[model samples]
Target: MKIRPKVTARALAVLGLGALVLSQAACASPTEPGAATTASAAGGFDYTDARGDTVTLDTVPHNIVMSEQAAAALIPYGIRPVGIWGSSTPDMSGVLAGLDVSGIESLGVSYGDVDVDKLASLEPDLVITGWYAGGYLGGLGAEDAEVSKQIEQVAPLITVSAQKSASASLDDWRGLAQTLGADVDSGTIADEKSTYDDAVSQLKSALAARPGTTAYAVAPSTQFYVAIPGEFAELIDYAEWGLDVRESPIARDSTSGSFSPVSWENAGDYTSDLLLYDTRAWTTPLAQVERDHPTVATLNAVARGHVVDWTTDATFNYASYTKQIALLTDAVKALPASE
Candidate 1:
């Protein structure tokens, strides 16, 4: 869509969060943006986010359709939108409480089928989507045409494609917010970054933190997979910061690089100091998994109380990542000081 040149300039006029506006020269030959800017282009938005092909909104958006789990990340920063996909889980409820949108028209149906008719009815100013493929694509299956048609009709569609890549972690969600023309608070992002760096440092400081201390993660799943925390989980590993440590590379059912299903009969095969678990699987309510195996109640983590629920409310899966990191840091801090 064509944004009025004047409105575009005015939008760039918002005070300062380091949003980069394209000079006529810069716009002519697109180049990779260095970082979330130090001076914002419009409305002090956080990043330039204008790709070779741009989706520029002339002003701070008033009514928006949030169609991905990443929607979880935006609502907290006061982008309280007109419509959002709802969630059924409760552990994630902490993250969802901040949204002030109560009575606006439901802007669009979530990841599942992309109901074109319902989306068009909401009449949103713009639609922001992420991970339609991994999150909702399974259930929707081969109906790509239907999905495309429904999405196109709602508003200008911007695809974040987060699901396509296994990222370092949730920070990727910030990139999406920048693209949406909302410059999220830098202080908030900086605070989160600082907290995260500190947590990792503390974990490294505690002598008990080590690679061999044993660690693994799992989703509250049906056909479960083993979750191996990558460089991301290293925050819990004490080393450069100093504390002896050694964690074996995670070993799971099929070498699939995901959390695995463990039974008490052979659960010992997978032992560790920490067990990270989540239930973000789009299908299969984690509640169902918890109910199906009361036996898991006997696992050492559950029995001794190391087991922690990753999320209660589904909506917060991607919404409150900073808070999520802070919570994760606190949870790790609470672990018994073994060294």
Candidate 2:
């Protein structure tokens, strides 16, 4: 039987104390191969994950399993996970969309649907998930409490927090990659970072030239819904980088990254200079919105040809973020200035 670590009252205290204690825990475990060496390159490794849990192993993990988003960020960093879970299909617009995942086994599409028998066969030494709420999110264990227990039977786990802005979450991914022996100074990484910086600059310039331009993000299926900028990670990053992402009123208890459902007749209520149609869902595209919904067609943004595709499926990494920034910049530049 695989033995789990005993969590003391001190470890529980760490979580209650928040980020300061978490940072200290990280400090306690040096990532370098040769320090005072409780865990070394040849021996083992220890890391304080986003949840303030210290996950230690007898040896550094080679076979790993990951959530889809974690796979997106870590794959480019040269850490190919053995298995991935929680994506319905290869998201064509996602950051990892074009990546060749032929070698990686699929655990299943959604969070609670992993093939535990298949998962066991992989013999994963580590399982990486995204942190949300009081537990890990976006993997075999997240949506099901029983699944979390089952996952614990297979391997040790750690979570990279996705609770913050996209940029901050990317930083956490980078830090995790570094701990996993990625060369942060590699030429590939450097080039991607440079591209990201350039894209940000381009976006800033475009937004500056088109002052007072505002955008409303929406998904139009059978029902129309308006996105609240603060609720979505990518939208938060865009707003921070000078894009005016208009917020729709959200219920206090509503899910994060979810939009407020609205009637087609009320679509005109959230009018803005730009209409960002969510292309990630199986909804009506902006091109077809006018023919299907007369109310949406009457909006100023749509009439002026200011509608553009939006993807919340972007990977929170330099390469993916840079591409999105450039796409947004190009879309904004094509728009005519409002009178």
Candidate 3:
């Protein structure tokens, strides 16, 4: 066989060029051996937040913000965040005490008041914010241009939304944890997840001990609201967490409010085994709920002392969906066992 030096040289040159291209691509891609990727990408973390927004973060975040669904997701990490979002009352205060964030509460911020300054000051490389950004984000330009820029500057943000429908946020909390924690909190994150998993397992056993019982939760803000588990309803999957969480016609009006608003006139129509209240508001005024559509007696939960002060234990964005399952589990257990 005759050897051709010219042809051999061309082949070697082409091979060299291919190597350069591959190296360049590796540099350009977000998914590096130690770097994070998207949900669809290998070692990816594709997540949808409360705002119906989809976002991807490489390798999990270490200094997570413990955004909207803190207890639902981050508390399990045992990271004891420097900051978190909360409601305007004791529910949040009490819930915080149970987790590692006890000292950082003031470091705590609210949904609409995310302390963009605080977040920026922390200068954290990564954050675990929610999809809603608690309305802190989006709808920029004109009036909100300044705050909008401020948020983008608060470090790269990842959005998370939990919903009842397929279009709702993805149940990627564990995946997100696994992804973000891979950086530094891997072992701690795993332990945190195990703790959460164990808590859930215990909750299941507790639930299994009893026969099925219908349950419902209400958050009394300025008005009355209900918490319904959608696609991200981890509580709905509990071992003993029973419920008939059907979407009410009122919910058809997304504008009215979520979890369903209870007017005094219509409170009787929605009674079940129990009714949970945000109580953070009522805790002070101590005013009895005036669900006047029917006398309070008309509602079975009210009749059975099932009406409860539900502040701690639930977790949602801004307590938005704080629908804290562990809190709910404990609360439901506190209920009088129905014979």
Candidate 4:
């Protein structure tokens, strides 16, 4: 039977391994603090983020606000922001579930639904969001110009790139953590880096033994949107790490978010050795996604039961991806050897 991802206590308990990796990160060896944490004549802290915009802070900017994705990265490093905005209502199934977020203010449930008044009242010094193209692209940042203006006025908004390779994003998060005064070399942050490296190594070893295995990523909803894996940070990292992530049958021109919408009848048009289905909400069972269009079963991966849960919609952070990659490695190990 195909398993559906549910937001239940049991599901979280199964996801606890990732949380364990994060909870143990705080004890790694410490490194020297970055200049951002020390006093400078500039009278504040400054950083050039993924968008290449310079965000300056009057002081160490203690009260922080961010999109839930950014919070996922910062929280494990002990840099808890004061407020968070999620794509949906806060739940225990999210990347931030392992940590206590009760004290963190919730801006709104979905993107474009942020409470500008409540956000401003938080009196935040810095706001972190996801970078798509050249601007903020997640949560409140995804709102209209007026909404963005309202939030920007309250605090400077910095973003990490959501379109870069996962490895790049991981490096950016490490830099961001240090800039935010986190001891990146010590604690859970450092431990996560080590775990991530080991996971990647394991993935590489598995792939090396089966170099021809191909994988395709898809987000299945009422429609099937087959992802061009290279376009996503995580998928790109997987490809570069030696997985045969294939390109899309049809190319789309959108930046950052791009996918080819396929009818169920043609779902098997793009098939591979493995099928990585999106794990976000709205994703139905593998059978249901191909209900009317039985042609999906013709896909090699599907016929061979090679489907795996892909966390493309979840937050991109070392702590999150470390666990994700480890799971992928395990999945690969479980696959039968090619003839």
Candidate 5:
């Protein structure tokens, strides 16, 4: 979910993934640093998560409760969760777009607002979510010790790292889904993987064709927030794929370090050939942003109409990223070569 520069403490808990360290009260169990793994022996379920804590159960967990991001990653692999909690409404969730969530129960519609009673009613066998660098669990407010403890009492919790490279994160999710008995080898999945690979290649080719065509990704709000490429999986992927995704001139003082809030007057400080605007964060039309923040029009990209909608909260699955990569590739191809 997009993080607002000004939001409630509860909302901040979810958005502060990069910088918010897990509180002792928020952790139900101790964590050790290790590579994530999934193993089953004698029909017992054992999965070591990003935090290196292994959760064991007598049987594979079928009744699962997941954070929105986790549900998006697993649902494509045919592993649907029984319930989900998210930072935004399901209909508005960019990560959950194109995925069917018709019957699943929504534990919460806002960040860190899970219905503990409803979550417990599901009698979930496990609770899975995305883990951030600072031990933060997606959708669970780390600052809400009582809620975290209550949720912990309901089921075993495991996490897949959200901070990893997009491709690596997708692999981790696939491994988790396989462990949960998903048909990862199904034709549908194979086809999507092929499509994703093609999309990646297309993106690389587009970048190669437009060498030095710089771009900056940003979310427009009351105060503009420039994306930090290193903190985001997709941005990191783009840079690695050869796109000149520019870093913000502003420092990373925000709670998450994922974005740095700057005044509109300073938005032009980091000029680029293309402006990848965060469509998920700002729902209004692009013209509205220009009208609201006159300074936005001063940027060369804005003046040249070289802006593209960037989905910052895209799902980590190949299917989701295939579309995102394709969109970015199209944007790259549309840009004029450096003067």
Candidate 6:
């Protein structure tokens, strides 16, 4: 499951404090072998996941079960899982776009809906998913402790954190994919990395040219949800790349402390030269949003047509990020400098 960066009240309430404490205390050192270890080692598969847990196996896992988001990251490197589960159908998942998943078994499509029996039937050697803040597992609800326990019983469960910056998360995936026996340094992977680097350079140049073009990333629902740039991997990358992405004061006062949800009537309170509008499936479409929340139309960014579609669920991979960065660069080029 691809988890959103935005933390809702319900999500906050379910966070496992004990898990969070364990994760902090057991945080592995940066130079740990498991972080950069390869599966080719004579001792067999040994890798440390985001939670800092070192999962050691007698042999490299050939049959794996992964969250669709994880599959998206690994598939590009030629690491295919035996089974996958997601928060949406494969066709509907933005992260799973342009990938071939015909041969993989579908464990489930909705959050917390994993078919444990089917997953076990596949005889998966490893179950890989994303680890999120609050100790939440991707595709599994925070409250679904029983399901998590059951999945753990079937196979060793591991994760890469979704809480890291896009680049950091991608690096983690690269290491994990290498541990899973992917040739990450050659052929298609190398070419993709070069392309991604070029895209990053282009985006930086674009932002440099468009000095002072402030942006506000947001999702429209019954409320106008302002994204906290620090909480989102892609948004953090954009900010670091020199875009003046605005921060929401509401996040400071929010119970979830991840995003600020303003009433539609107060949507005009936050404004920027450019608007990074969330276009995830869960958000209300921009056109419908404008019609329903007329106040949103009053924002200067909206009036000037300076809105850019932001894919919140983009995969943590060079290929996916190369496209995202290109789109943002184009948007930056089109945006006018702030007054």
Instruction: Name the candidate that leads on TM-score.
Output: 6
Q: Across residues 1-339, which tens digit of lDDT does each residue of candidate 2 receive? A: 112352222322333343111112223443322112244445565666666666666566778988788888888788888888876643432547756666788787765777765766677778888776445466554534777766655666677776667877777788777767788767788789788878888888888888877899888886677886776777887788777898766443344336777778888787887788887757777667778888888898888877777877674678877777777888889877544
**Model 2 residue 10 distance off true place after TM-score fit, in angstroms:** 28
For all predicted structures, in order, the TM-scores are 0.58, 0.82, 0.58, 0.82, 0.85, 0.86
Model 2 scores worst on lDDT over the 10 consecutive residues at 18-27
lDDT at residue 111 of model 2 (Cα atoms): 50
Query: In what order do the candidates fall by lDDT, top score first?
Result: 6, 5, 2, 4, 3, 1
lDDT of 4 by residue, 95-152 (tens): 5756667778888887667776677667676788777643546775443467775665
Instruction: Please identify which of the two predictions, 4 or 5, would achieve the higher lDDT against the true structure.
Output: 5
The residue-by-residue lDDT of candidate 1 on 1-339, one tens digit each, is: 121121222221222233323322122223232123332346532222222223444444555766434355566444655555544221233335555556644433333544455555555555554433223322222325576544443455443433322222245455555555556556555565466556545544443343334445555444544443332232322223342223334355553433445443444444445555564544345346446765554555555556444542332323343344445445455566554
Candidates' RMSD to native: 9.0, 7.6, 12.1, 12.3, 8.4, 8.0
lDDT tens digits by residue: candidate 3, 49-164: 34433344443445545453444345554444555655432235544444444455343334345555565555443455443322543122221456444444444445443333
Q: How accurate is candidate 3 locally (lDDT)?
A: 0.44
Q: How far is 195's C-alpha from truth in model 5 (Å)? A: 0.5
Model 6: clashing residue pairs?
none
lDDT of each: 0.43, 0.70, 0.44, 0.68, 0.74, 0.77
Kindly provide the TM-score of model 1 when superposed on the true structure, using C-alpha atoms. 0.58
Candidate number that wins on TM-score, 1 or 2 = 2
Q: Which is the better candidate, 2 or 4, if ranked by lDDT?
A: 2
lDDT of 6 by residue, 1-339 (tens): 111121112211223221211111122234442275443447467677776666666577788889998999999998888888997766666778888887788889888889887887777777889988788888885625888976765667788888878888888999888877789999988999999999999998888877777899988775788888878889888888898889777644544345787777778888888899987777899889888888889898899888988887784778888888888888788875444
Worst 10 residues of 1 by lDDT: 3-12
Q: Highest lDDT among the candidates is held by which one?
A: 6
